[model samples]
Target: MNCEHAKGLLPALLDTALPADETREIETHVAACEHCTRELAALRKAAHLVKELPEIEPPPFFAKKIMAEVRAASVPKLSLLKRILFPLHIKLPLEALAAVLVAVIAIQIYRTVGPESLRPSDMDPPRAPEKAQSREVAAKKVEIEVGPYQSRTPVVSEAERPQARDEQMRAAVDKAGPRRAPVSKDSDKKGFAAPPPAKKAPPAPDELSKTSLVLEKKAKQSDVETPRASAGAGAAGFEGPRYKKPEEEKASKPRELHSDEIGFTESPPPAPARTVEAERPAPRKLEAAPAEPAPPPPAGLARETGADMALDRPWLDESKKAGAEEKAEAEERPRAKSAFSAPAASAPPQVVTVRVDERPRAGEKLLELLPSVGARLTRKQVRFDRDVYFVEIASKNLVALVGKLKELGTVGKASVDTAGDETVIELRVEILGRPQ
Candidate 1:
């Protein structure tokens, strides 16, 4: 048999599974081929080693212990809802008992202090002295004669009647030019008389004109005088005290000194003034000689031909040179690849280009992430199309905020910019379908 066929039967031969003919053939091949002989010996050694190992029996109650551990491990974790509901079992009875106690106390309070306290007292009755006196007067009766008699009206002459008397008095008043009526002697004796009307004094033409002129003059004088007086007072208030030197005051008030008044033996003669001539050093020549025109700058230091005017524009000369080199290499070959080529293979785009697509909409996802990340949306704008949202968020913990935002939704686009000391995150969210 060939070496491959004999080697395949080696394991079966060790186990004594091969038939007599095949076993004899394998044995003959092993005897002649050194490789096959070594392989057979290795197989025999492996079998012997496996057989020599001692068998181990399990300890008592091994299955029970294993089953107990599995049951403990398999116990499901408690969810928020389960934990919340668990407390209701103990709380419901306690709450119900508390409510019952409150109701009982309310009912007892109502019974003790209710409508009975508001009712009027029956023990005391109201009393009035005036009412009692009126009742006493009403109780006494006065008898009246009830004889049947003819009723007669008093006869009054037309000329002697009160109507005639009133007309006569009115006519007399008109004829007398509003003179007072003469009171009867009986009325005068009774001490009752109407008072006389007061007379108004006649007005003088000259007095009215003089009074008006006097008032006008007084108003003009008051207006003119007030400003000058106020200005003088203000000037006096703002002016500072005049400061006189001590020597000048002493010269002005010179007094002859007596022997006893003089403190010194004699006044020392005034010292002559000495003018100081400081030896000022010659002024150092601080002005440097005009520097010779600097040698023309090196080529590297010289400004480039296509320098950007905007400060923010990055210097792309190195990148351009590298791209040119790559292009040259590609051109030298038969196939010249374009500088901007398609992606190498079919795979997810690089992290720099592609962003995660959050499943939840932008606004809701940001709200969910705010508390966990401890971030605030300082500024936000929602698009009219309801498909995009732009938000500016600030946070001290930038790492945590970025991490939470990634988990909140698919981050379509994210950028970090700084404003003063705070980090401002600008996010552009692409709204997807409604959340589940």
Candidate 2:
């Protein structure tokens, strides 16, 4: 037999399914040919290896579990009619029957209590006597007038009421008249009539004087009151009586030219003065004394005077020199102080450092923790010694990353440093031996 023919029969020969003659032929050829022999040996070894594997008996519910999974994966082949006529659950049918029953009950109740059944005509009807009584009561009600401008007596007929209202409106309009009118003396006289003077009884001289004084006081008060009244009228935009000045009143007043009205008295003659004698005084001779010169002021007093003069006028040489020196000294003093004093130094940036000890397989631990920490492995570098591993990871949230790192391994020391707008975190992981 050829190698290919023997190879095809090999599996059947192992299972002992071939005829005796074919099996003998295949075994003989496989033994003789090197290629077929090696193939036969490899097949026998594979079969032996499979047979040697431990048999695992399935659990009691294995078949059921497999069937459930198959059902979940498979799509049910339901017909349209079958799907539409799917069996209703007990609860659904019960709920539908309940709803129908409630609807029937509601309909029965509505019919029993409907408007047709409870209408007044079907229950109780109004009698003719009630209509007549209501009519009489309405007729006896007298209409009462309402509103401020309405008359006390209500007008029953509409035709006469409008005419009366029109008359009243016309009367009110006529009474209002012109808003502004010139004040005339005739109108004033008509508005205010003077009373007739009463006959006075004979009075003593003192009583007459006292009466005159009272009359004068009253006239002054009347003048003052008149101005106040006129001012109020002016403020209200109404024209009032205008009073004349004293001169105008005097000029307007009529006076009688009689001898009794004016009289001039003559001056008395001058008297002559008597002459008196004058006493004479003796004369004395006068002598002229020489004028003495004034002493000069002391040096200190002169210096004080100069200083006062300088203070009074700072433009003077002494004051100007002193002021300029003082200003220059003040300017130089600040410069010297500033030169001696050092500038304040700014505070250093805060740095936090943390150390972790004896963490072997740190790289593996970091890789396991990367997903939990929400960090992406940017770059990874293994040292030439293969003992140290440098891992660069990036995370949007630093605090979460730090927390996750702490949970990952023993945190010997951890530090966070902030510089300007950026936060820098340094982590040093120590491996006991070599990285795996």
lDDT, candidate 1, 322-379, per-residue tens: 5544333222110100100111112111111113343335456666666665554322
| Highest TM-score model number | 2
- Candidate 2 stretches greater than 4 Å from native: 19-21, 56-104, 108-436
Lowest lDDT block of 10, candidate 2: 277-286
Against the true structure, whose lDDT is highest?
A: 2
What local distance difference test score does each model get? 0.31, 0.32
- Model 1, C-alpha of 360: deviation from truth (Å): 35
TM-score of 1: 0.18
